[model samples]
Target: MIPPPSARPFLDQAGWAGAEILPLAGDASFRRYFRVVEGDRRAILMDAPPPHEDPRPFISVGEWLCESGFAAPAILARDLTQGLVLLEDFGDARVREHLDAAPAEEMAIYTRAVDLLVDLHEQPAQSGLAPYDRAVYQREAALLTEWFAPAAGLAVDASGYTTAWDKVLPIAEQDVAPVVTVLRDYHAENIMLLPDHARSHGLGLLDFQDALAGHPAYDLVSLLQDARRDVSPAVEQAMLAHYQTRAKASPDFEAAYAVLGAQRNAKIIGIFTRLWKRDGKPRYLDFLPRMWGLLERDLAHPALAPVADWFAENVPASARGQLDAGQSAQ
Candidate 1:
């Protein structure tokens, strides 16, 4: 990948005049990542660029994660105005990468990840963080109708879905679980496993800038019901049990997990569809089957009765899966 010229000055200003700048895997966001290597030292250069993206939230959240004793990349240098940041490279040992190499270790890795979440939930509130309340959840869930439904060549009115969620969400909130930082994308792809640190801190967090003070179950669901990869039913159940036992959570926690899981899956279905239709990324569509299955399972929870009924009434089973090839929703 070609390094954009706009990033050169920051490389020089940050004292890496002749480093080997190699492109790193980017996510759904507009931000691009590049690894800067000079001899034995290495760092990540985040090119968030222009008006579409901002790195301040990332920097702030990174600091918060680090301060709270979790593993977030250290911001070594930055130019907020230019949306450029140099971060400490935690190396390539991601949990997904490790699991791919040794599937036998999946249980251990996921258990550690779940344990990390339990600890992360205990953190004190951050200043200026927004609440991931019902309105926000409803708005996010609308992505299904706004992008996915049309992309699938079906006319779906998302208002009913949102309306149903309006009724179902209160059951989740009434449980009295303390709201904590919800790292909106806490799935395997964004998590790294650093062997050098202790088990809890070993899990390196990424893509958490969009975090809000929300239900603790949101992130947990994000991990267990990941859209990109198929986490086995056995593994998902074990991790859930592990978390509940460690957290000493009340019986209502499982209900909240199902509710949040349903909301998150609904939001992802729309997001994956939008990514394909608008961004021209079709691979996201491949995960639709797995995501749909997860969504269906989440909907089975009695807590999701209203939203589940909305889906049943609006999105017919025949219209759910992979759509026509190479057709833009627009």
Candidate 2:
């Protein structure tokens, strides 16, 4: 694949002018990725065009992770004006695809991931990062009412949704746990299994530009309750126990997990719907049922009573079921 014209000068400056550029991937946002290869040398070219995307947060967080001894990709070179960055390549062994091929190794692999989080939570969070405060939580939860509800042909109680979130969000922000860096998109798809590294230090983190100072439970919920792939409930439970024991988390951790799970799932449902309706990406609709299933499970937790009641009253079981892609986005 051809690199964007603007990337040429950046590549020339980074001394990778003649590298072969191959299309890598495009995510939920407007940013695109490309793999750059020059003989034995390799790097990832991130095309985070301005106006819609920024790479500075990604650069800062990644550098912090590297300094802290975590496996976030290293920033090799950057040209912020042209929105091009050369990043250390973590290879193709993403945890989601790896698990799909080697189901038997799922437990061991996930154990390492959980252990990484335990280690991460031990460190004090980076300063100047935004807190995952109540306003953010409420705004996120309202995505269900804003995009998904309308797409699903349900006229939701938007104000009631906000009220329900107001009642429960504080539980997630309680002082029972120390605030740590929450990698807001931590999930199987975004974690790489580095074969060259030792098992304990092998997990490579990606797509963490939106990291925030938040409760430790938030990232765990994101990992175990993934939207793109099915993480068995048995594995999820075992990992939760493992993390709790490993981190010596408070008794309130589970409650925070449920609250954040519901909030994140709600945001994802709205985002996926928006991707379909506004961004012309229908493939995301395929994950709506899985998202609803997880959201419903989270709502079953006693900690989510207020939000659960809101869902029960405003969004029926019928609206939350499997959606036909062609019909749903209409």
Candidate 3:
């Protein structure tokens, strides 16, 4: 693929003048990635357009992860003004791809991923990170009403949803212990299982620019309750139990997980809907059913009664997954 005119200057400045730039799959963001190859040497070029996307967070978080004994990509060259970074290549073997290619390795691979979290939570969180506080949670969950409600032909107002969430916030925020560096999108696709590397240091991470200081359970929930793929029930249960046992987490950890899971799934439903309606990317819609299912499970937890009650009152059973253009004006 021909590099975009805007990207070529940065690529050339990074000494990839004669390299072949191949398009790599991008995430649900404004940023784009390209694989650069110069003979046997390789690197990844991150094109994060400024004024909308920033590369500073990724650089800072990458440094923190590397310092913390994890495998985040090394930044070879950067031009923050242009929002471009040439990064050390981690190859093309993502954990999800590896598992799909070799089904038998699923359990062991996931265990290692969980173990990485175990190690991360033990260290002190990086300084100056934002908290995944109540406002943040409520703001994110608002996407469900703002975008999904209209797309699904519902006329639900955001006031009731916000009020209900306000009630649930106190209970959900309790027993959260302390927040860590929550890699907001820790999942199979973003983690690499480096061959021949030690289990603890083997996993390579990507897409962590949005890391926040949040409950330890949030990242764990993102990993196991993935939006892109189905995590088997057996594996999810085993991993959850393992994390609780290993982390020596509080007795209320399970409740926190359920509440956060519900909140996250609710946010994603809005995000996916927005991605399709606003951003013109409809592939995210296919995952709505799975998201709804996960949200249902989380809502069932007694700790999420307030939020669940809000959903039951505002969103009718028939309107759960249906999308149209009837969203409330506010």
Compute each candidate's TM-score over C-alphas: 0.96, 0.97, 0.94
Q: Model 2: which residue pairs collide? A: none
Give the residue spans of candidate 1 off by over 4 A: none
Error of 3 at 69 (Å): 0.5
Highest lDDT, which number? 2
Candidate 1 steric clashes: 0
Instruction: Tell me the TM-score of model 2.
Output: 0.97
> For model 1, which pairs clash?
none
Candidate 2 local distance difference test against the native:
0.88
Using TM-score, rank the candidates from best to worst: 2, 1, 3
Worst 10 residues of 1 by lDDT: 321-330
Ranking the candidates on lDDT from highest down gives 2, 3, 1
**Model 3 C-alpha lDDT per residue in residues 1-330, reported as the tens digit of each score:** 445676777777778788888999888998899998989999998988888899999999999998888889999999888888899999999988888889888888888889999999988888999988998999999989988887776788689888878876666578756768999999999998776457355889999999998889899899999998788879988999999999998889988888889889999999998888877777787888899988998899888888888888778888776354343223
lDDT of 1 by residue, 1-330 (tens): 567786788889889988989999888879999999999999999988879899999999989888878889999899888888999998888777778889998888898889999998877656779999887988888888888777766776666767788888886788777878988889888888887768455788888889898878888899999888789999999999998888787789898999889888888888888888888888888888888899999999988888888888888887777766568544
TM-score of 1: 0.96
